[model samples]
Target: MSESDFTVRSVPMLLSRNKSQEWRDIVLLRSGMLMRFLKTHNLLINVEPFDENGNVKDDLVIKKSHLTDDGLELFKKVIPGWSQYLDKGGDVNNINRLIKGLEKIRNQ
Candidate 1:
């Protein structure tokens, strides 16, 4: 996809009413499909929004990095080609499987 195909919109990441954080939200769409695609191909850290109707929205937050040093080594040992994805980001379902994968890599 061309650069236009990937849109990084800057929005305020609020820490609280008085404090905030800065981050970029990357979104990819072609023919109306939104995948969290990153050049680094790392596992994405995602945030989902639930509507008042109890339906989940497509909104997600994609961090630029995935995998801690130990996790990276573990992943590389177990899953070949894991490093490419670690250095990038892509969409995978947000579920227990993902949670478990991240749990292993998360900082202690």
Candidate 2:
């Protein structure tokens, strides 16, 4: 049920639900909480487990875009090669990705 759970799908709800700012706040909080819980259980989806080439493995759980800054920070602590994957001099693509990821999390 993790894939279809309300906490996983935020923009559109299959069930009738409140749309107030207060409700949205609660939803965001719950979503964060859910991610934390999943992380501890090793059930969260995302790019972890680098391949032999030191890149992300072919697997996913929670998406990076859906994560809050705190969530990403927490998740990063668990990954082995997160730093190696980032920080190329002229190639600021990963930097931009980090910024966008953080912004999207904060905006939510």
Against the true structure, whose TM-score is highest?
2
Q: Which structure among the candidates has the greatest lDDT?
A: 2
Error of 2 at 107 (Å): 39
**Candidate 1 lDDT tens digits, 7-56:** 22212221122332221112212101212222123432343323465332
**lDDT of each model, Cα atoms only?**
0.31, 0.41
Every model's TM-score: 0.23, 0.30
> Where is model 2 poorest over a 10-residue stretch in terms of lDDT?
86-95
Q: Which stretches of candidate 2 lie over 4 Å from their true place?
A: 1-11, 14-16, 47-108
lDDT of 2 by residue, 1-108 (tens): 344322323323411277577655544443343333444444445434334664323232355554544555545643213224432223312344444444454566
Which TM-score value belongs to model 1? Answer: 0.23
